[model samples]
Target chain A: MRLSENRPSPRVRAGRELPLSGKDLLGLLSEVLAKGVRIRFRASGYSMSPFIRDGDVITVRPCKKTDLRKGAVAAYVRPMNGHLAVHRIVGGTEAGFALKGDHEPIADYPVAASGIIGVVDRVERNGRRVRLGIGPEKGLVAALSARGLITWAFRAFGRNKGSVT
Target chain B: MTDRTGLDRIFKPSEEIVAREIEGELIIVPLTAGIGDIEDELFTFNASGRAIWKGLDGRKPLKAIIGELAAQFEGDPEEIEEDVLGLVEELVKRRIVVEVV
Candidate 1:
């Protein structure tokens, strides 16, 4: 009956159900504590060799398609199924834009504007927050994309096909 | 036994499905569908069932999970094993899931 009582983690063993999924948790803290935040209970195996590994928490900022700049990551509903895919913009589109992960050694494909979710402006790492704003390191991501390094291992091992570069 | 080396099945063009726990229920939205059908099939579960379902990552085996869940939930291990196997069989049949490492 008591939820926390059944949890396995000592801190969470009390069955303290944290209703805050990464997304809701970010929004709640943003409004209450007034700190910019964004995250969600994300689970997927598509994007590979991401500087961000699977199960890592990220801070996303909801943005408009017009606001998307080169080298910013966005999460959006797939035009087909609306599955949330977190990837960075490699090329710009007047309607939507093209997205590919730095680790993905695939070609750049365009997604419709409707599929766009939000730009990931930051991520919470270890206990500190890291912001993902535009910068020079963008070149590194490109070179890796060219070499197909970050995503090479995952592409060889990922469940998803090597579709996007 | 697994179907094949993870390589043979890796590039067969499987659609990406979005699954999430919304309001205590797990919802899987298929990214690619049969056109114009707004509602896809849904899978529902209770609290305990959800716990067991969450444990079904591509890694662990069905038998191992039964023993783990029995201890965690304080249930009959044999009975739980049957239940877990039944669920896995159903999931595989539906094509919503695949046995993978």
Candidate 2:
């Protein structure tokens, strides 16, 4: 018997696996960071897709408020829902910083500088470490993100499917 | 004479374990392997587990913890000791808790 034949389908696998919400993972991440530890967690949503696909592993390190800047990817708590969001820092406000997913249409609710927990330093995809901020993958993704092509693509897909949310 | 395997050992919460209280539940994440996949490693504690976890503050003996838990919960002292010891042993194996001198 082949092992591949025994593998469960996506729907069945999803059902068998326990679901961990973004808020739950973020709560643990925050505590680990507070203990001065670097943590890695799997990404689970399509908000930051293409650049960060679902199931991709992300390595994040504790960061200071001064370490954040526009164009950087930071993990922050969305005030509206208290859920964690890993999004790009597009701009800043007097109160805090503005964030948006690379493929999101609109910016999320502004997160105060204090609410920002860690900055993503590396992303693991297909067992390879793609360092953020400097590299070919970074350059390509940053370019795509800068021009908002990913967001445009997402919107187009939603429009075509008539499932725009 | 010490009871030996009868709650003489003192254990403390491992520094490698990071815990959070969310919505009145205790969630523990063991940071033994730095930068490893952590979402897959989270362990949430139940009401009884939470009681045992909170008492492992590096200063309390296992016997003291058992006494407190036994008072809060309804059970025989020997049975409570057995359950607490079993849970602690499991946590020790997972590196979430450590036995201290």
Q: Which candidate is the best by lDDT?
A: 2
TM-score for all models, in order of appearance:
0.40, 0.67
DockQ of 2: 0.15
lDDT of 2 at A79: 86
Query: For candidate 1, lDDT tens digit of each residue in A1-165?
Result: 322233321011110133334453333322311222233333234463345555445555557646576666776544454445677676655656767766565634578765665666555445455443234565455445545665554467573355434
Candidate 1 local lDDT, B1-101, one digit each (tens): 44754222211112333345555645443323321111213344556556656766665666556657776766556666556656555555555456663
Which lDDT values do the candidates have, in the order given? Answer: 0.49, 0.69
- Candidate 2 DockQ category? incorrect
Most DockQ-accurate candidate: 2
